[model samples]
Target: MPKLIVVAGLLLALTACGKESTPTPPPASQTTQAGSGPVDVNVPVEMRPVLSVDPPAQTPAPAAPDVLTGKDGSTYRVGPSIGDFGRFENVGVEQVDGRWVLNIELPDDTAAIFATWTAENVGKQLAIVVDGELVSAPEIASAITGGALQIAGSFTQKEIRELERAITGK
Candidate 1:
């Protein structure tokens, strides 16, 4: 009797597996109402909802000071360039806006540097020197232009005069 009962259970399970799965459609009431004329079923499908992402706000970067080196190889701090100039080139110095500017031209695209004034370049300060002493290590604000640029900072009358003379070899 136990064997017969097991066989019956197996048969029932087999029969259930043989049956095909049929999806249940939504109720007729859920569908759109039938129209009197030939209803165009070719209506355009609605567009899917797009994800809206808000970009972070833009903030101005801090300005980087100019770097100067003195005759003794001592570094000094200076200010940013006041006017627009071209790319930097060669080792030379010039005066702009009454300040001494060192022109250290880098062989790279410096457009991004000119775009902002920030303090990010503080650590990688350029070494500016006059004669042989180090003047300052001002962070490069942008690339040099025409192999010349101006340095800005609080300078005493003697310091300015000395720097001008050292830079110009006058």
Candidate 2:
């Protein structure tokens, strides 16, 4: 019984020592810095100097009201207000009825707004602005009613995503 107790006590002491010897991680701010020479070990673990890195310089964002070239080589000017109708809540582009369409969600009060905008602007270029940039300007083909309208033009995948992002306000 005495030998067994001594062995158990020795095992417990070893386990406790293992648990206590675990190296503590430094604070969140400190990290291993890269250097050409060998790392110095004399410095205190907590006081070891790390690198001070400045964030990447922010480039000036491009100005708005810029003209963008569409896939069909047509130039489109960024419009001041692309979808200002109160009815059109979320406008998006999609394919419907065998043609690519610009879907606009409309409320009850702005039912006639889409028709009026399309009717007055058919054959005239209107800017499809996304993220404050003129993405594409496709001519209004015809006056459309209801909550959906089709915008037909030569559009690439990038242009489609840009237009979708802009229309969705994402």
Candidate 3:
């Protein structure tokens, strides 16, 4: 089980670490039919270990080709490559304490599996990916046994609804 809810410094990661900084898909990729894409509720994939880069110049030329720099001169770590990926039984956009969140409910069997995985990987991050882009990566501090997960972020109604469609495929 994952730490049921991890709201700690997640926004900081978004603002400082990159990725979830923008709670919406790139304007270019925005669409009216988001149901076509799939959302992978990874612990950002399993809240796996990640290093946000503040690049150094004159680095070794032998660096991995995939290690590319962002427009802001920051490096984007290829995340989202390592955690668990699955479809939730339900996904909804709602307001909790004045903040909008993505509420996800997993299937019964998956809830048990997630509990085990989260227990083993405490302190790691859980990444949520939609269309292969890292949307949210919140750290897991405890195990999550229930199928319900609430991912908190700065979301507009449109972004949250779009995410809902993407995850539900409806």
Backbone clashes per model, in order?
Answer: 37, 1, 17
Question: Which rank order by TM-score, best down to worst?
Answer: 3, 2, 1
Best by lDDT: 3
Question: lDDT (CA) for every model shown?
Answer: 0.27, 0.34, 0.47
**Candidate 3: segments with Cα more than 4 A from true spot:** 1-84
Residue 142, model 1, lDDT: 30
Q: Write the per-residue lDDT of candidate 2 for residues 124-160, one digit (tens) a residue.
A: 4454443443333433334445644323233443554
User: Tell me, what's the RMSD of every candidate?
Assistant: 37.2, 31.7, 9.5
What order do you get sorting by lDDT, best first? 3, 2, 1
Who is ahead in TM-score, 1 or 3?
3
Winning candidate number (TM-score): 3
Error of 3 at 77 (Å): 4.5
TM-score for each candidate, following the candidate numbering? 0.27, 0.40, 0.52
- For candidate 3, write residues 73-151 as lDDT tens digits: 4444544344354655656566655555566666676677766766676655554444444444455555666766655
